[model samples]
Target: MSAADDRLAARVRALAAAVEAAEGRSDAAVSADARAVVERAGERVAFSGSYTVVALAGATGSGKSSLFNAVTGTELARVAVRRPTTAKPMAVSWGSELPHALLDWLDVTGRHLVPSGPHELSDLVLLDLPDHDSTEVSHRLTVDRLVELVDALIWVVDPQKYADAALHEGYLKRLAPYADVMMVVLNQADRLTPEELDRCLGDLRRLLDAEGLRATPIMAVSALRGTGIKELREALARTVANKQAMTRRLSADVTVAATALAADLGTANVPRVDERLQRQVVAGLGAAAGVPIAVDGVRRAWRKRGTVATGWPFVTWLARLRPDPLKRLRLDLTPGDHSPTEVNRTSLPKASAVQRARADQGLRELTDAATSGLPRGWASAVRNAAGDRRAVLLDRLDVAIAGTDLEVRRGTWWWGLFGVLQWLLIAAVVVGAVWLLANPLLLGLGLPQLPPVLWYGVPAGTWLLVGGVLAGLLLGVLGRALVEIGANAHARDARRSLEDAVRAVVTEEVFEPVEAELARYRLARQQVAEAART
Candidate 1:
């Protein structure tokens, strides 16, 4: 392919991708019409490029077939007085071998090859299309279909219906974008007086101007009287010579398709998943996954384990009597053992209706934040994407929370030192008590008198009993205070870890899908912009 052909093909492919991207998200009719344009243009571009396909289109009783015959200098199409005479299209090819593939693609069965003539119009394949305003729906349908495929259109109008609303409003205005490749011919001009013909041509020009077709050429032609036929043939010869009709027509098609889809590409500003939105998502998921309750459980469990480790040895049994809070929640007491099977369902309560509603609202807010500047259609698509798997969101979140390894083990060195000290103090107090109790037994057995120990002028036995008991109580109280503080810090850390895990789930389950949709929209916008550019 040449550079121009490669460019056009690339554009067509871009347009096709845009249409595919918009299939389910955009209006069905708009997407279908764009798809049709892409398909038809692709077929035309791939076929023979040597000939230009020009169609003579008009309403009923406009002498379109007569103009067709006059231009080709052969009676190719059957002209009749009956309304809507040409039910099917007839083609007249000039100068070269018949483009059978092109004609077949156009579905024009009636073909005529004209001998080479003086007009130098050898590269033209002129078609006489059915009346666009025919009472028969099929004829109008045929006209609509062929008009889209033709390389250039010569709209044949008669003075009687030159300014008719049906012709101007239905065909001319809709095709205004193709003005560069369109022409208006006032057929049967010989029937009017010269003065009347001039007035009618001027009025037709004004009407075309109103329809936004000011650049489209208009000429007066009479197929029967042969007036102004040369000018029409010359105009067509120029079109065939330039060989840009196909490109112009295809470009116009792209414009129309892109314009139809412009509403969907609301803004060039791409939507983003920002940190604030991600935080909102994490917060919501945290609530739904019951992170607060789990964190609280971890804190209580930490304190319980700390009491067992650092409390006075005799009273520490009381702490052991209570179940470990983390164990009750099915959380691992040890850190870093994160086997999937080791984790179990948490005893944390299910999310209440209020919490679930808050979570849902948070998700909606995140969606709104991400799609803030987008068009309504695109915003709706993004929101829908976020909620696509909403039914399973809670289950996934629960599993994520369960799988998170919250570091809740209480293995501090200070606690172990405090535990040994508590044990040594308890031993001192027990030994002193036993020594005092055995005094009576020693007297009853008539044993020798025990030596009295003294410390700072007081008996060492009394000092051991009072000092050990008091110090043990003080150490236990201080250790409990330290454990409480440490537990709170641990709880905070665990909460943060759980939130991070939930955020990961939110990103994977919600934000990722929404982001993917936004990416698609961005790609589609880029492709459309490229295809629509000149």
Candidate 2:
């Protein structure tokens, strides 16, 4: 085989693999034709090495059977005996043995071999197909089947019907991609004068070119007169001798499959999962997972802890009676904190109907974006797969919320300092109270009356008690202001972390599958391009 032929075979193999992968990931309708090509290519290549199958195809009265006999120089195919109603193809090969296996695959039952003689037509399996324009439905179907399987096609037409609508519009227009393996024969040329033949050939060439078969070879021959018979034989010999007929035919099939597959692939690139998209999805999931409630828990828990540490020292003990906001909501426990006996589910309330609706909309938007520019069939498949993704979302969100660390430790650094200062002020008040009581006890016991220490024209005991009271009140007010600031800070932090966790969940449960499908799509396109390459 030539280097070009080897390259084509390798490409066809790669194309087959790519088509198979696409079928598994794609909708059946989108991939049906391309997959059929892949199947046909595999079967055709196995028999391609032995003989090149060149089929004679034409309308009912095109003298196609006569041309087949003229090229092979034999009456191997009974043109006079075959009826227009015959659907079975007559295969005439010059091989030593009848090509039974190959014909079986082609579903051909009638076969013959030319007697050993000059072997110019050897290495060729020539088929005289049934009339494509036959009145019989089965005959037409048979032509269609063989058309797909043949390695090369020789379309015969008489000067009178060379421009027939059924042959040109119905077949040639669609077969344009297989131009390399196809040729048009203007048969019965003996009926036309030299000038008439030139005009007719020109018209035929124009029509074929208009149908995108500009490179398709055209010949004017008379099978009965043996006109241009030897040249046609030489062309057939070259097609057989180069051993590239099968490769060319399969390559054209690849082109046809790739072109069809490209329709479903659309002219768009894959969509991405950006930060903005993630944030949108996370917002919805956070609502469904009680993110607002979780943030509120963080704020309240921060203030609750702060109250005990910085409230009036005498009254702060009462603050301990309040429940911890995080503990009550079970947001304080990370997933790793769970023991073997603990359940994985959190104590957060179930999402309300409104929140659930919001989440579903978000997930739907994701799939919509993923399939934005894709064709209907592929988009439909991706959406169906997204249904399975949606099933696990609620469970995934629950785990995400449970796994987030909602504790606020950085908000409590000054709490100890405030508490110690409050206690020092309390000691001053206690000292003042003791001094006042000592005076009463000493006077009653007839001891010497203590001289009162004065400060700013007031009794020292009164100043000590009053000043401590004023300072402690001022400090308590300042502490409450600080607690509010810290609570807001902690609330924002918890929201960020929870949103981040929710983002991770959606990426795994939602976007991963979509990306996998996108990768498959890219692979299909790449493979098709390779298969369609020359």
State TM-scores per candidate: 0.92, 0.82
- lDDT tens string, model 2, 337-451? 6797886667889999999898888778877887887767567667765666676787788878877877674446698899898888888888777777788999999998788
- Which lDDT tens digits does candidate 1 get at residues 1-534? 556667777888888988877767777788888899899887998885778999999988889988888888887778776744788989998864678999999999988887766447887899999888878898898898899899999999998888888888888899999999999998988899999998998888888898899989999888988988888888888998888889889988988897777666765588687887688778877887789888999889888888889887778898899987777776763444446566456667888998888888888888877788876667788988899888888777777777787776546889989999998998889887776666677889998757777789887777778888999999999999999998999999899889888888878889889988888888888888878776
All models, RMSD in angstroms: 2.7, 4.1
Query: Which pairs of residues collide in model 1?
Result: none
Q: CA lDDT, every prediction?
A: 0.84, 0.81
